[model samples]
Target chain A: MTTTAPARPAAGRSRRPSGRRAARWPAWRAFLLLTLPMVAGLFVFKYVAIGWGFLLSFNDARGTIALGDWNGLDNYRRLLGDPAFTRSLVTILLFTLFIVPVTFALSLGLAVLVNRLRRGRALFRTTFFIPAAVSYVVGALVWKMSLFSGTPSGVANSLAYLLGHDDAIGWVAAVDPPLYWIVLVTVRLWLQTGFYMILFLAGIQQIPAQLYEAARVDGAESEGRLFRHITWPMLRNTSVAVVLLLIINAFQAFDEFYNILASNLSGLGRADGRTPLIYLFQTALGEQNYGAGSAGAFVVTMLIVVFTLLQGRFAGFGRTAEEEG
Target chain B: MRRRHLGSYVAVIVFAVPFLLPFYLLIRNALMSKRELGSLDWHWWPETISFQGFADAFGNDAVPLAHALWNSALIATISAPLSTLLASMAGYALARIPVAASKPVFFFIIATMMVPGAATFIPTFVVVGSLGGVNTLWGLIVPGLFSAFAVLLFRGFYLRFPRELEDAGRVDGLGHLGLYGRLALPNSGALFASLGILSFIEHWNAFLWPLVIGQDPEFWTVQVALSTNLNQQAVNLPALFAGALVAILPLVALFLIAQRWIVRGVLLTGIKG
Candidate 1:
């Protein structure tokens, strides 16, 4: 799964192009023809942007993206110094820390449960996966407007009323309990848990049934025992990959947070829910502070890469690459 | 080995509710009148189904729901095929071509994936803005199509492609492009379908890039327009729900129709970074 790319083709392949003029020229031409468009576009759009943004981060490009005003680490220093930016960083860090483990457990549990069902498996899978197809903006709209709306008539509020808590809580507004986390977390769970569940289900399905049968025969009568020994261990790769993706995604969370907590034109509505991307968004686009924005983007990217590398090291995520290579 | 577990059934039903809740509320409120939406009455259903919400949503001048949907469709249609072609070609080349630089190229593309898009977004925006791509459909479509993830997937698919087929195609006088177009591309329907669906759904649901690129109302994708509508002062609640319904239903329908390929595409995520 990690390294299927071959360094060279097989012996009899004409594409190897034995010292023939026409064959070699056409082969090179085809390689360029095939890969040039996408590689060039990526080089320009991604690599060039990264280079320009790196240079831009050091300069005071406020209200301007032009590069001559070299400030030399001022942008990075200012961002780290500003409470809002630092707070956003802390906020995203906390989000990634919390959301990754919770989502992992829930999705894994859902996958196990769903996989056990002989009846209505597709029905359950479709129901769970449907939200994955939904746009975050729409999901946030529904969650914000109907489910978590501050009004007493809202579903959550109404449910609370039935439970004898008569107060119509402002789920997205209350900072005392930081109830906005509830809206943000629940919406993400609803929207994303199912997708991860699918990945786990695929992983679970890949384990041979004979292993479970053999386990059942070897005094592993209980489902929990079977899962602990066979299912969990067999799912090591999937679990690690899922955890890695969850961390990256948790760090990159902007859409639902922006949609539910932000009042787009007014910017991020509260300090409580501001993630790094939203902060960078407001900085770069809203304030036209491209310098700070570029700097923050670099910081966030470094954070993600650091976490990924850490996971790769401790979790042995890229171990398969070595084997296959 | 297939056992009937009551707990699994119970848990699935319980878990399915939270996932289904938002969709239910979205549709329910989208049908209800503004009065019914605000009512304190504990009615399980809207008093009466109404298209007025949809009417008001599509009717809203500032957000322009109908036009936005059209723009999104156009962007998705163009971006999907274009990305699939380019990504599939690049991916296949990285997989099959014995070019000396292929391994370096693959690492470069994958490295691009490691950096979050937002980090490089401002400069990307600057490039496009300088190229006069802002407020144009191409502004959103062109830049967004160059996904390294997509290239990675195609490369993975082609790595497993049998050498015998290409060997046979060589005997037929087909060059590499000719072989890809005629021999490889035609047979890999599953990959094409999966990649095509992946690209389309991505373009349709994309928010940040579309928002940054399509500043004018004329170019607003559905997500951008819905976002603008939600943030507007004095938002019409029912109309917003209606707009959301209009926005998500196409994808929902598409998902149900193409669940097989979409899930296959998603499962491909486990292949690698």
Candidate 2:
């Protein structure tokens, strides 16, 4: 997929000059016409908004989103000083750290297992990948209310009862031991792991069958050995991409967190599983503190950028196909 | 080998149950009465099916669940096709045109894909708000139309488009516009279908942006409506589950129909990235 990009249209370009004399006006016009709305919308909605947000982060623009009230880092300082914002950052960092590796391993393992199946591979793949299409909000609600609800009738409580655990545990509300992590982690793992597994499955399928055959002929009798020497090495690019995507998706963890923890009568939880996006949502929208909210946004953005760049550095993400070859 | 196959089957089923169980419970509970749902004994299957929950959810007084469904459907239907069209156009320009700025433009759009959505969250709200977009469906629909990911996908597809087809168009004196409109667009139905389905599902399931923009209950999308039900004390559990079922049914159906294309799109994303 990456390599096909730069193979470019030298053949098309050769014909381009001949057509250029006749088609110059139309080509330029078509290009502009085709690209203008998208470019303009992107510029206004993304670039301009980002610039405006950067400016707003330096202002005291609370209760309003308008600019011109300069506060000179007060918003940043305020957020950095506030424990809730900092705690939310810590919460997300820990969530990412916990979720990324576990998800990576689980997805990779599932991919290997599913890929090796000689029959019903498509059925299992569909069964697993269907959840990827389910909305996180719906998934979270299902998890929180039905699967892990605090009531005795909830699925987890029923299982617990059957196992002789008498108490109906408040999975989302549990704070002292942070049992909420179980709920948070499980829900996210369920929602996302399949998608990544599919990614790994595709990566695995891309490996040449001859590689495995050759490894087998070389007296690599065990499946594990064949996997370790051939499949694992061949899947490096995919593994890197999966990890990168997982980290980004983890850092942007709001939907499940918000739906499970905050989208109830109890309101946003008392510092348990409150991610940066949730915190910023509360700040900017709930309290009308746009300045501090924007500041927090940048802080999280920087965190995401740092993590991505670090991963890219290690993974060599942006290197040209020639460079990799 | 038979034992190994059995073991594999067991492992796959065991791993799959957690993923499948939620949907099972969701559907089961959605069809049960409140009394049935709250009973101490779990009913794995509904002893008697009831549509009371669906009825309640649709007729809920505080939040307009039906309206929310309509809003969600409308927004998704409009946004998906429009966004796919715009992205395809931009992608065609970037892929085919010899314009000097295509490289930078393509990269710039791709770079936007990495901009953590949170960074854009507040400012986009502000921008959209300034455009008198708050409380309007246009606000929700317009910004989402510019998807960097879709642009990249279309660009990737266009880059690999058979040049012979366009060469034929050129010989027929079809200009760039004619070629794209006549030949390229018709030929790229699969790409359009895949991207359009993805965009539709995305917009359908969208919550945060819709919640922020559609503060009015009249404009609440299905996700926002379901979330509102979650927060309310009077909201019935069975009804909530029913509401969720209503919201997810279309998307699940869409996925089943377009499963091949969607899966292919996902694999392509992995490969290209």
Candidate 3:
């Protein structure tokens, strides 16, 4: 997969061209030409639009580019007082806190299982990985209609009935806050853990086979002993990366919630349905309240940035202890 | 040691069951006729198997699902190659050429990784919408073609590439284009192919942008069409599964075809520093 890049050995040369010649071929001209399009196309799209959105948080319709009107900090002031917005923020926090740890634990356990597989390793890997390829629509549809559908005809409800729970509760329309959160987390875990398992497996494989051999020779018979001696320490960084990725993904989650709950939000019920992203979309696009949406987006972005930085700091991601060794 | 192998199989299967069962049920459900599907009772196996569901799905006139598949395949083929080519170009420059501003450029490129696509969706929609690209294939294909992640992968691959080949090319009086074509691209065909498959799968299975842009069924990608087809009031459960099955088949086939390299590439993301 590796490809050698073509070297321009003359790159460092200060080609001292005379007045007209220098004008014709600038020293930094080539670099500018090569990078400007990418910068203009991507950087402007990414950073500039984001910056504009941030500025729009403080602007009324005229001040913001999308829907023009100026009313400074009006959106922010309203956002600070908005109950639904506040609820979403709290819900997202609770959701992330719950989901990240669960997925981490799940991935770690699955990786350990895969690492132990003497055969059918590829089959197991493929089976888990297949769903990772399935689009959010398909996953959401299956989960909604088949897995957790409220109707008696649904698979989950049927199973629940079989298990002696006479109530075939509608998973999506459930009014209880905790129940809704559980459904969301379960679906997220089902979709996500496989990808993380692959990552964890990669980390597991990097733990030299010889170390496990040595552990076995030293009479490490139990799974706990094997993990303690040969697996856990090696997987620490992998775990960190997985946790960080999960946090980011969990915060950014929109599709599953959006699709699963597409039926319910007639604005009449409790708003636990809104993850911060969904809330932002609802407030801005659905409600035509762009200012509030921008504020929400900014808040979510800051929260994620802070969380990532804090996690990376603790993970020692930029430079790990092993790198020093 | 032999006992450990047996133990491993048991452990793997136990772990694999939860992930595998949903898919098992999905296929089982897909095969079941409407009478069986709508039944309140659940069974591991249906009393009979029929292609009724498949036929119902394929028979729909509103969605040119066959055309959606063609559109998806066409878009994927074009976008994957183009995106890979762009990534290779950027990757080559970042890895090979030593410019004064390369670090900053590389940093900027990598920083785009954290820019969530959801945040950009509205503005991107506006841009595409204004350009009259809405309900068009270019709307679907063009946006997905530009990926910072792909470029990063190519850059990582390039970083590991041997320098001697490029030097040898330079020794033979080849310029930048020749060096890339003759020395770099050929050596990296496996990576390119893997990348191609990855990008193709992503574009093929794409839902969000296509959904946002392709408002009409005529322009729908297979994925968008499948989901849209389902959202109607007259819920065609069997037809929905058939559409879904069609959409997933290409990706599964591609994965099977390129399983070795795809798995390796997947593994590489972690193992590579």
Per-residue lDDT, model 2, residue A11, is: 45
Candidate 1 has a TM-score of 0.95
Per-residue lDDT of candidate 1, residues B1-273 (tens digit): 423577678778998887888888888888898888888756678878888888999888888889999999999999888888898899888887776667778887887887777656777886787678989877888898888888888887888899899989989988888889998888878988887987898889998888888989999999998888887768788899988888888889999999999999888865364
Judged by DockQ cut-offs, is candidate 2 incorrect, acceptable, medium or high? medium
**Model 3: residues >4 Å from true position, as ranges?**
A1-37, A62-68, A177-182, A216-221, A263-270, A317-325, B1-7, B61-64, B129-133, B268-273
For candidate 1 chain B, the 10 contiguous residues with the lowest summed lDDT are: B1-10
The residue pairs in collision within model 1 are none
Query: Which residue pairs clash in candidate 3?
Result: A60-A69, A60-A71, A61-A68, A61-A69, A62-A68, A62-A69, A62-A70, A63-A69
Q: What is the C-alpha lDDT of each candidate?
A: 0.84, 0.84, 0.71
Name the regions of candidate 1 deviating beyond 4 angstroms.
A1-6, A9-18, A263-268, A317-325, B1-4
Clashing pairs in 2: none
> Candidates 2 and 3: which is better by lDDT?
2
| Residues A150-224, model 1: lDDT tens digits | 999999999999999998999988899898888888888888898889899998898888888898788899878
Cα lDDT tens digits for candidate 3, B72-169: 88888899888777777777666655565666777787787776676556545545554677889887777665567766777778777887877789
TM-score of each: 0.95, 0.94, 0.87
Quick one: ranking by DockQ, best first? 1, 2, 3
lDDT of 2 by residue, A114-150 (tens): 9879989998988888887788889888988988888
Q: List ranges where model 2 is wrong by over 4 Å.
A: A1-22, A263-268, A317-325
